[model samples]
Target: MTTEVKPSPRERLLEAAATLTYRDGVGIGVEALCKAAGVSKRSMYQLFESKDELLAASLKERSAAFVASLLPPADDGRSARERILHVFEQVQSQAGAPEFRGCRYLAVQIELKDQTHPASRVAHQIKANLTAFFRSEAEQGGASDPDLLARQLILVFDGASARAGIQADDLTGLIAPTVAALLDAADMR
Candidate 1:
């Protein structure tokens, strides 16, 4: 017989924060988070310095899976243009999910509204890393202006994510062509 070990209190709390904050907003209070995690407020504090720290840690913990969900594997042998489009294709698929709520990092930044907040900083770094990925891919694709192309890609990504998140746009015929145009304009192969 195999015994399934339950997650520790700390892991449960992190899971709860990530799920609740994404579904609801960062406005979710500690009480609700503890209830979801089945942990006590005292235990929550003992595991984390504060709610902000918990939020930050949760974001940090999920960063790897988040990036993997978007980014193509490193050196997959696809052209730069193909790699870039892979990201948007992933976004469009994710948006089709019923639980999609735009980008979590973007949501956190919008809700916190304080760049210096611990969670805000973590969110910022995650986005910056995404932009950096675009830049690197742009350079590899031989874009006319890698920086410009990267910025344009991130803008489209965030815009598409936000719009689809709110159900304002299905992105059915949108993201792919828009990204292709940008890549074409940048003269990327």
Candidate 2:
């Protein structure tokens, strides 16, 4: 016999928060969040100190999911450069999903705007972590200027995500070859 333990209240709330944020963006009141999570306001307050804390926790969860999905493969039989470029294909596939709504971190920044906001801080940190991944990959691929290449790659990624989310366009076909050309220009491959 096996016992199935249900998700904790915090897990349920974070899951609900992530889904609602993807569907409706962030900054909804605690009452609304409680309703969405199917937890009571008392439960939410017991789990998180405030709405900002809940939102920040939810953003962190989403960021981890993004990193796990978008990180280049280590031994997937593709060159590091191709693996790096594979991020676009991964993101494009994710964007095409029914519940996609661009990046949730970007959504928080757009909605909050204040640099001091907790959610804004979380968003900035998530972006910095992504940039770091690009930098590391660029270095491993033998780029002469790994830092610069990483910055450029982040720009391309940002643009592709924006276009994919806003214009509903498919960029997978162009991304890999374009990235390969950049690697070639950098004497990487």
Candidate 3:
């Protein structure tokens, strides 16, 4: 008779890693992650072989979720600017969520010294894709120098993330006006 195994150890590890990485940043150790996931150290090692591999998988999982969350649901019927602004709104909303921490990618970047790590590489790719998305939207909106506009908006985005992470305060007020100014400037040029 074969007994059905419950949730796989790998799944548990990934879930735990995602939660712990988001809540405490990537500085969290493998042991803690295994414990949180309710997996034995041997199980974790069996699945990932090393912390770096586990981290890479965890980062990938988080990146996928983050991008999915950024997508506007059907029926929102919002303009590009509104959608962009909505991203900030979501960030602000996170401030009130239980166990709120800073951007997971940024946290990993800070904790990991090696720029070439798989986790770091994936994080950088995600940022670049976001910037490209903003630039494309700006260009389609007929903004002169869409690249520049995208860069400026990225600054605001990064600033908001950093401020919220560091100060534990919502920077939504600052972001709204600045975004408006950006759109206005884009319109003029």
Candidate 4:
């Protein structure tokens, strides 16, 4: 016989918040979140200081998996150019999914419209990390201007993700070429 461990209330709330807010936007109410998580309002309050705190904690909890999904494995033996492209490829793959609502971090920041909010701060940090990855890779690839290339790469990423998420573009025949152009302009091999 085997026992299956159930997620604790905190875990369930985090999962619920991450899922619900991504699907419904940051305006999702506490009642809906607690209902989805099967946790009571009182329990939620006990676990988190407020809804904003819960939202930030949920985003923080999922940050590792989010980065893992987008970033290439460490020392994957690929060139910096290839590693950089890998991130876009992952985004393209994810955007193809029906449930894809664009980048959750992007959505949260936009919806909250408050940089000082805990969740917004968390979202900002996550995006900064992505930009840092691009900067590091651009430098390693010997780009003419790593800073410019990194900024351009992240802009492309954000745009592609937003366009695809909104179904405005499938991102097919789009991301790779645009990225290649940017890479070439920067003289990255």
Candidate 5:
């Protein structure tokens, strides 16, 4: 008979950390995360060696999931600009979902002042990856300076997130016009 082993302590800790950080932000303590994940502190330490390591892994996982969610599937057949706008649409869709707590990486960065920390490093990597993705898409859409366009789009993305978090309103209306202008400028250049 083939045996199926359940997920390990490390797997449990990673999953729990991702969930808690996404829902409650990164300020929650390690003990709370361990308890929520139903794993012992000893097991967590054994797997991660330190809370910083565990937090980094969790943030990495969350970052991957966030990017994946923003990307359209291969069959979507959308233009690059459309695909980019669709990302904003997805974010807006999540606004109405229960318990939406805003972007996980942003939350972690805001909570941690020491940028040298492991979690902060992971967050910085995530932001870089996201910015690169935007640049690539902009280039594919024929933007003259994909790098500059990507930076501008990132500003719009961050501004929209901030508006949503602070005003509890969808900011896509403001974002869409900015993206439209960007696309128009790209066509001109």
Candidate 6:
């Protein structure tokens, strides 16, 4: 015999927020979030003090998952430049997916830009984490200035994502060569 355990209210709610907030927008009401999660408002309140808290939690969870997916494993047997440029290919593939709706971190920031929101803080931390990833890769690639190289590579990664959201087409062919040049220039290749 086997037993199936349901996901906790917090986990369920975060899953709902991940789908709804990204698909519809963060303007989605608390009621909608609860309904989608198949959870009671009480459950939501029990885990998170408020809807904003849930929003921040959702963003944090989603961004961490996403950045992990974007970069390949360190032992994937590829050079740093190959691994780095692979990110552009990911951006295009994700954007071209039927449900693509821009970067969730950027989406939340746009929704909460004016206010001093915790979601905004989480988004900034996600970007910092990404920059740190790039810095480590640049070091492996043997860049003379790994920090600056990481910053530039991060900008390329960001711009390609923004373009992907708007263009919603495979921009990898256009972006990858430039990144290759960047890697070569920095001795990352």
Against the true structure, what is each candidate's TM-score?
Answer: 0.98, 0.88, 0.86, 0.98, 0.86, 0.88
Model 1: per-residue lDDT, tens digit, 1-189?
999999999999999999999999999999999999999999999999999999999999999999999999999999999999999999999999999999999999999999999999999999999999999999998999999999999999999999998899999999999999999999999
Cα-based lDDT for every prediction:
0.97, 0.79, 0.77, 0.96, 0.78, 0.82
lDDT-wise, the better of 1 and 2 is: 1
- Per-prediction backbone clash count: 0, 0, 0, 0, 0, 0
Residue 72's lDDT within candidate 3 is 57
Sliding window of 10 residues with minimal summed lDDT for model 4: 157-166
Evaluated at residue 11, the lDDT of candidate 5 is 79
Best-fitting candidate, scored by lDDT: 1
Which portions of model 1 show Cα errors greater than 4 Å?
Answer: none
Tens digits of per-residue lDDT, candidate 3, 96-187, equal 56565667777787788778998888777888887887787777667778899889887787777777777756674676788879888888
Per-residue alpha-carbon lDDT of candidate 5 for residues 48-151, written as tens digits (9 for 90 to 100): 87888898998887666788887677447778888778877877776656666666777778877778999999988887887887787888888888888889
Q: Which 10 successive residues of model 3 have the least lDDT summed?
A: 68-77
Who is ahead in lDDT, 1 or 3?
1
lDDT by residue for model 4 (33-146), tens: 999999999999999999999999999999999999999999999999999999999999999999998999998999999999999999999999999999999999999999
lDDT tens string, model 6, 1-189? Answer: 999999888899999988998888878999999998999998889999988899889888887578877888767999887788777678767877867766777777877874478878888789888889889989988898899999998888777776676664457477878787887788776
lDDT for 174 in candidate 2 is: 68
Clashes of 1: 0
**Candidate no. 2 TM-score:** 0.88
